[model samples]
Target: MIPVKILTSEEAERLGLKKPTKKSGFGIKGVGCVVQGKHGGEGKLMEEIILRENGDLELVFMDPEREKELKSRRQFTGYLKQFTKIPEGLK
Candidate 1:
């Protein structure tokens, strides 16, 4: 399973990501996901996140070209912190 960075609303802003919404019914809002490739380049599956009250985080890892060329976006998401790290630029 691929790891995805989990940034708080403030952290996301520092990294130029979207902010969390105060009115969101979800417990976690205004979070951002960033996936970095092994070749020292950033991945393109950038998106903001909202964690439903009882939902979980998910992720997947694959070659970039394959990820893009793949016809469907049936991706898996998870909240593991192995492949992900708080980006140095944000820290």
Candidate 2:
């Protein structure tokens, strides 16, 4: 596998990551959010259906394109840490 260049905070800032003005806020960037699930009211059909090897169905990410911004898994985790109290199941 190719080594990925991890972006420094300064580098991320140069790429349009504005420093959070709020106290206790994160100081990083290059992150995006994706959401997918039932919508248009309860019991509505999901937008995308994914069949897993375990035979479970999962919804397609609504913002897959946005998720491509992260360079590595660590970056993705850090980004989520900024806004989420991650559950043990997800961790």
Local accuracy of candidate 2 as per-residue lDDT tens digits, 30-68: 333344445674442212334444333343332333344
Per-residue lDDT over 1-91 for candidate 1, one digit per residue giving the tens place of the 0 to 100 score: 9899888878888886664555355454334455445676766654333444435332333434533443255433222242233323222
Please give the lDDT score for candidate 1. 0.45
Runs in model 2 with CA error above 4 Å?
1-62, 72-74, 85-91
In candidate 2 the C-alpha lDDT for residue 27 amounts to 31
Off by over 4 Å in 1: 1-25, 29-34, 42-48, 54-91
- Alpha carbon lDDT of each predicted model: 0.45, 0.44
Report the C-alpha displacement of residue 35, candidate 1, in angstroms.
1.2
State the TM-score for model 1.
Answer: 0.22
- Candidate 2 TM-score, C-alpha based: 0.21
